[model samples]
Every structure is written in C-alpha cells, then in structure tokens.
Target: MTLDQFEARAREFLESRCSRRGPVATEWGSGEERLALFHETTDEQERAEAEAALAWQRERWAAGFGWITGPVEHGGAGLSAEHDRRYREIEAEFDVPDMAPLRIGLGTVSHALLAAGTPEQIATHAVPLHRGEAVACQLFSEPEAGSDLAGVRTRGVRDGDTWRVDGQKVWTSNATFADIGLALIRTDPDAPKHRGLSMFLVPMNTPGIEVRPLRQMTGGASFCEVFLSDVRLDDALRLGEPGSGWKVATSALAGERRAVGDRSHEMNARAMALLATLAQRTGRADDPAVRDAWVSLHSRLQIARFQQQRMQATDERTLTGAERAIDKVLLAANYKLIGDLAAELLGPAFVADTGEWGTFNWNRWLMGSMGYRIAGGTEEILKTMLAERVLGLPREPQEMKR
Candidate 1:
C-alpha cells in the first residue's frame, strides 16, 4: 500500500480512540513538576496505568496494528518496518495511553525470545506478549552479576523432565506485574561460566517464586528483587541449547539499549524546554557561564537526536552491535548532565522542599538520572565494549575466576 493510504488508515483508527494532542503547557509554575526520571506511582496508580495501556494494546492487536512488523504466522499484521514506523509517528499525534509498562515485554523480552525460542515457544509466549495478552520481564541480573552477566549464580538442576531453579534476581523491571519471566540460570557448574548457563521461561505464578519491590531513593519501586527456591519448570521452558545462554541474553540486552535510546529523545526534549524556562524564571538565562553549559548540552543533545534519526532510517543489517551502545551511553551521560543543570538552576533550594512550584521538586529527577547510568548497562562496561569492539582497541584482561 502507498504511504498516504497507510497514514489514512492509521489516522482513522486513532481518531476513533482518542483526540489529537493539543499544544503542551510550558508556562513556569504551571501544571505538574513532572521531573522524575522514573515514574512515581502509588500501587493503585500503577495498576490503572497498566490497565489502560493493556486495553489500548489489545485493541491494536485486534485491529492488526499491535504487531505491525511482526510475522503473519505469529498473529501480527506482517507489514514492512516502514509501516510500523509510520504508524508510531501517526500515533504520537494523538493523546494515547502511555505504553511504558509494556516496553520490557515488547522491546526486550520478545526480541530475545524470537531470536532463540522454538516455533512452539514463539506462538505460545512471544505472540501473547506482542498481542499484549500477557506481560514478560527479564530475570538476568543477580546481586553480584549486575553487568557481568556471565557471573550469574542462579542454579538450575535437571530432574526427570523438570529443572529445579534456586537463585535470586535483582533489579528486575515489572516483575510484580509480569506474567512470565525469561530467567538466566547456571545449569552446569563444571563448565566455563559463560558456557554453563541456560535461559528458561518461568511462569511468574510458580509455586516457589517471590517478587519483592525495591524502593529507590526517588521513592519509586520501578524494579524488584525476585527469589526462586526450588522452582520447577518443564524442559520445554528452556529458550535455547543448554550452553547458549550468553547468546540469548545478549540479544535482549541489545534490544534494551536501542529501546532506551529511542524513548530518551522525547524525555530529554521535554527537559530542555522546561530547563530553558527554569533559567529565565530564575534570572540565570543571562549568565555567561550558564549560557555556555546550556549551549554545550544543547549541541550534544541535538547531535544525538540527529544520530538517532539516521539510525531509524538506516537498515538494521548495516549496523553493528557496538552501535547500540553509543545511544545508551550518550543518553545516560545526558541525563546526568541535565540533572546537574537542574541542580544549578535550583541552587540551595534543590536541597529542600519549600512548597515552591518547580524548584525543589527537581530532586527526584537528579537522583533518578543516576540510575539510568547503571541500568541497560553500566557506563564503564559500555565504554569498554565500545573501545574494544568498535575502535579495535586491545582487549582488557579478564580477572581469572578460579
């Protein structure tokens, strides 16, 4: 179909659901402070957001818009990637419900499963995820294995037809609400760390699994710590060959980095607009030093925006895995920089809540920005990967774990 036809079809579908978004309110001391990097939601509020997002996704699935670029045999529209991009561009014009809750399932989990799952697994688990019938979360990080994924200590011992899992996963997003978890476990202790691991799909409601929310300094429980004790799963739940866990885990991490970059531009743009207003209101707009910092940040952010647009237009096959790290690192640094700018603008007021409109409320954003640096992948780790993989530098010596 023609691009115009595609636009018309998407517009018709969106118009039936919601009206176009009006101009954003940018006035100082107006509306919400909204500076938090992570969502600050009560339990009730979180559930409401989830329900609204799921409802919208289910409708999109029924109308063949949920999985635009997904395969036809897997319950998707089987359209081109361009069609998917165009639909999202059009969808942005309308006031649709936020789909942040479904991002892990759609962006990270589904990509990894599609790459490594069997046909039956794809149809059973991946399809429901794309259709928004169920939510999935990755269970990769452990207390000691945050960035060093190969060091994951979660154990899985085989029985007759089931594997007994026992380990703890930290920093798992959406675990409290996820229906399924893609868990990485050590299946063979005698093999090398990377080779001994395996991936599995565990039903979240399994008998011996527990999810406890981890509250951040920003007072948001966006991540969870999960414990699995004697959790048993059928062999069919295994994602790939016993020793291919590294391959399957990296697939999801790559998707996560790209997704992080894709979603960051808009958030950064909004912060820039708000910070510009903050500067003028606080009389720092005319300061030469403030101006210099603002310009530098602005230039870097604008370049990052252009880089992302170029990537979106380019073919995925032409890109390298190292390219994904660039966006993640760029945005992560920008988030901290923006937080610093906010702190400078607010000055001493940034330390205390004085009931001022936009002053002290920015504390959440600054604290939360630091989390992004460690999320997706740590800054130190990604930079090393870029140096060795992208720049052809000498590899860093790995400390032998004997």
Candidate 2:
C-alpha cells in the first residue's frame, strides 16, 4: 500500500482501539503522566495502573505498529522513516499507547547499534529491542562531563574476552526500569579523552550496576543515576571499535537531536486546545496581551512543524554537526516559549494544587520545560556550539593537558 494508505489504515485501526473500553491511564504512561492517572491513589493502585498501560503497549507491538522502522530482519516492519512518522501521527490521536519512553531505546540506541554493531551483536539484541522485549537507557552524562561529553572518566579495561567497566552516569532517563543500557566510558585513559572512549551495551540487571532515580522539581523520578562498579561485558556486546565511542555516540546523539524538533508538534494541538480552555476560563481571551501571546505561540508551533518537514526532505547524514546543534537549541527554546505562554495564561495554578480545571495537569509541562533546558545538551552549551562550530570562531587553547 502507499504511505498515505498505510497511515489512513493505521488511524482507522487506532480509532477502533481507542473507542474500546481500554485501561484508563495517564497522558503518556510515564512518571509525569502518572500524577494525572492516579491523581489520588495508593502506591499499589498506581503501580497496577502503570503495569496495565505497559500491557497495552505490548499489545500494540504485537499488532506491528510498535516496530515500524525497525529492521525487518529483526522482527520490525522494515518500513521507511516516512511510514513510521505517518503512523505516529495517526497513533498520537488515539490512546492506543505512548512510545515516548521507547524513543531513546528504539529510535536512537537501537538504530545506532544496528548501524555500528557487528552481525553477531545485531543477531542477539536488535529484534528483542524492536519487539519491546528489551528497554534501553543511555549512559552518557556524568557529574564532570555533562556538556563536555568527551571528558567522561568512566573507565573500562580489557580482561581477556570480556571488558570490565567502572563509572558513574548521571541524569540517565529510564535507567531505573531499563532492561539494557548503552554506555560510553574511557577504555584508554592515557590517550586524548575523546580518543580513549568505548561504547558498550550493559544490562541494568548486571551485578554491580546500581540505578538510583533522581526526583525532579515536580517530584517525579524521570531521571536517574547509574553506577557501574566493575561491571563486565563480553567483547561481543561492544558497539564499535575499542576507542570509537565518541563516533558511535555522535551518531546516536544526532538521531536524538534530530528527534527533538518533532516534540513540539506532538503535543501542540492538545496544548493549544488546553490553552484556549484556560484563556476562556480566566477571562483572558478578551485581553489583548493574552491574544498576542497566543498568536505568537501558534506561530512558533507552525514553524516547528515546517522545520521538521525541511529536515525530513533531505538525507539526515548530510546535516552538519552544527546543524544538529542548532536543531537542539531551537527545540528547547520553542518548548520553553510554549511553557511561558501557558504560565501566562494559566497563572499560579500551574504550580499550586488548586484543584482548578486545566491547572493541575500543567505541572508536567512546567517541570518538563526546565528539563528541556538541561537535557540534550544544556542551552548554554548548544549556544557555544553554534558560535564555535557554525560561526567558525577561534577555539581557546587548553593548558590542562599536562
């Protein structure tokens, strides 16, 4: 079938599924969404609710929508990227499932692994990842190596056919529940920091791997700290050459950075609808200031979609590293702008538990806005990248190399 036909059929299938009396869950079946689902429930009830939502996702995977862009040899549909995007558009309208959690695992990590992994490596894990039988988390960030990712001190050493890893990763999303984790660490500390690194797929359940969830401003554990204490992995699990972690991570991060541009488009329609409700409820619809802000918000939302289309029309590999950095900066700024518009329209109801309509649900956006500033490279770092790389400015010499 044509791509258009596939999307149409996918939507029809989703509509039928959404119409059924499926399990009622939060907005996205995530920590942020859990507050909405079990607004007032015991821990046991919330756990059960989360499990039910995950079960729904498994059902969708079985139906073929879950593995749309995955390698067909690995139990995926082996469809083109456009097909997956169209299917996501259809799937988003209904409550069939929320695959945001899988974006890093499947979209970024798995795709990168498939690109860089050995044939035996692909044979062992690619299909399981596509099938949702495995969940993966990125182990990239560290206390001293947040924006300067190459400065990672996490160390790995060769031990016969296996490598031992010891490192600390911070701000790792989904690590607490992830089945497998893709981590970058220093395999040869004596070499230049960037050249000494290697990437490995470490299981979260492995001995000496500790995942501690970090609470956000909104009181959710959306991020975690991963500690690897002499964790070991067979050479078979390595993604690329011994010291090619930076290259591998760059590719994976490029995919991630590319994916960010689509975030605003995902929830903009729903957010706009909610904004109108808030405006009317607060009697701000008549205010000229509010109207102007609303107009600006709508324009930004459209611009985000347009940029996405432009990026899609070209081969992503043709994009410069700077271009990817620009995309990350734009995505974060657009989300913050949207969050600002919401705060203006919704007021303090966004933070306080006022029990007012359209207010309580905004904590997710408020919290997520700040996170956008930090995650995927902080705003400051992205701006520096734009200046140094894109603008062709002189680089500062470092004296600490001794």
Candidate 3:
C-alpha cells in the first residue's frame, strides 16, 4: 500500500480507539509543560500508564498495526520500515498513551528473540509482546559488568530439565513490572568468559527473583537492581544454544543502541525546543551568545539526524559493529551538549527547584543526561570501539597489574 493509504488506515484504526488530537503547541513559560528527562511517576501512576499503553498496543495489534515491520508469521503486518515510520507519524498526532515503557520489550527483547529463539519460543513470546499482553526487560548488565558485558558473572547450573540461576543485575529498567526477562548467565564456567555465557527467557515472577528500585537523582525509581537467587528455569527457556549467548546479546545490544540513539535524538530536539522557548520567555532570544548556542545545537542536531538516516538506510546484516556504536556516541554527546546549553540559559534556575515550572524542571534533563551516557554503552567504551574497530587503531592495553 502507498504511504497515504497506510496512514489513512492507521488513522482510522487509532481514531476508533482514542480521541484524535493535533500536535500540542509549545507555549513559552508554561509551567504545565513536561520537560523531565525521566518520568518521575509513582508506582501507581507507572502501573496505570503501562496498563493504558498495553491496552492501546493490544488494540493496535488486533487491527494489524502493532508490529508493522515485524515478520508476518509473528503477528505483524510484515511491511517495509517506511510503513512503520508512517504509522508512527500518524500516531504522534493522537492523544494516546506513551509507549516508552514497552521499548525494551519490543525493540530489544523481541529482536533478540527473533535472532536466537526457537520457533516455539518465538511463537509463544512474540505475539504476547507485540500485543502488549506482556512486558520484558534485559538482564544483561551486572554490578561489575556494566560496560564490559562479556564479564558478567551470573551463573545458571543445569539440573535435568531445569537450570538454577543465581546472580544480580543492576540498572535493569522495567524489572519492577516486567513479565519476562532476557537474561545472560554463565552456563559453562570452564569455557572462556565470552563463550561460557547463555541467554534465557526467565519469568520475572519466578520464586527466587527479587526487584529493588534504585531512586535516581531525578527522584524517579525507574531503574532497578534485580536479584536472582536460585531462580529455576526449564531448559526450554534457553534462547539459543549453550555458549552462543554472546552472539544473541550482540544482536540485542545493537537493537538497544539504535533505540537509545533514536530516543536521544527525539528528546534532544524536544529539550532544545524548550530551551528556545525559555530564551524567548526570558528575553534572551536575540542575545549573541544564546544565538550562537542555538546555532551550534541546531548544527549538531542536523549532524545527528544525518547519522541516524545513514544508520537506518543500511541493512542490519551489512552494518558493522562500529557503525552501531557511532549512533549512540553521537546521541549521548548531543544530549549532554543540549543539557549544558540549557544550564547556561537558566543559570541558577537550572540547579534550584524554584516555584517556576519549565525552568526548574530542566533539572530533570540535566540530571538524567549522565544516565544516558552509561545506558546503552558508556562514552569511553563506544569511543574505544570507534577507535579500534572503525579507525583501525590498536586496542587499549589492559590496566597495569596492581
């Protein structure tokens, strides 16, 4: 179908489920506007939002618009990526619930499953995730293995049909409410660090699983530390062949980097727009330094956009690991740059939570900026990848012996 036809169908589908709303106009100095980097929702509020989003997704899935670019056998439309992009364009104009909470499920976990899951596993999990009947989280990062994912020490010992898992994962987003977790565990400790790992689809409600929220500087407990103590999983839950988890994790990490990069561009644009409005509100729009900063930010945004388009156009099979790392590096740096400019614009107000709404709220963006740098991959790690892999530089030497 043509783009217009697809959009019309999407519009019709969305209108049937939710009210049609035009793009929200940004009003200068409106304290009611949301400018937080991370949502500071209470547990009740987060649950409500997640439920509403899931319902909307299920409705969309029922109408054949949930997974536009997903494979046909997996309850998706099996259309081109452009078709999916068009649907998103149409979605933005509606007053539907935000789908941020479902990103890891749909973007990362689903991709990982598709790459390495068995046919039965795919049939079981894909539809539920696409329909938003279930949510998933990544259990890759650990306390000692944040950037060095290959160094994870989570262990899973095989016992007949089940594996007893015991490990701790930190910075696990959505664990508090996830139905399933895509976990990496050391199944073959005798093998090399990278090769001994394996991936599994673990039920979050398993008896030995525990989730503890970690409150951030932005006053949001969106990140959590997950403890798996003797969590038992049937061998059927394993995603890929034993010792093949590194490959599965690489695929998921690629998806994660792309998702993070896309979100960074979007959030950076919104934050910059808000900064422009703040300048106008404070009568600093025409100031030379402000104009320079605006121009610089716009230039950087354009560069980031170009990089994003390049990444999107390249087929996933043909894209190199360094190329994947570049998008995230640009994205994280761009977000930090935008946050710095906002601080320069607001001065003291950026730091203090004054009675002002939009002004003080920028603290959310600034505080949350650091987390983005570390989320997909740390700046230092990505830079090293670019250097060694992309630029043909030698790998950094291991740290000197203590």
Tens-digit lDDT string for candidate 3 (348-401): 988787777677777777677788789888889889889988889998998886
Q: What local distance difference test score does each model get?
A: 0.87, 0.73, 0.84
Residue 236, candidate 2: C-alpha displacement in angstroms: 1.3
Question: Which segments of candidate 2 are over 4 A away from where they belong?
Answer: 8-66, 321-324, 345-353, 360-364, 391-402
Residue pairs in collision within model 1: none
Query: Which model is ahead, 2 or 3, in terms of TM-score?
Result: 3
Which pairs of residues have clashing backbones in candidate 3? none
Off by over 4 Å in 3: 1-4, 264-266, 281-283, 399-402
lDDT of 2 by residue, 202-232 (tens): 8789999988767665655567788889898
Clashes of 3: 0
Task: Rank candidates, lDDT, best first.
Answer: 1, 3, 2
What is the TM-score of candidate 2? 0.83
When 1 and 2 are scored with lDDT, the better candidate is: 1
How well does each candidate superpose onto the true structure, as a TM-score?
A: 0.97, 0.83, 0.94
Candidate 2 steric clashes: 0
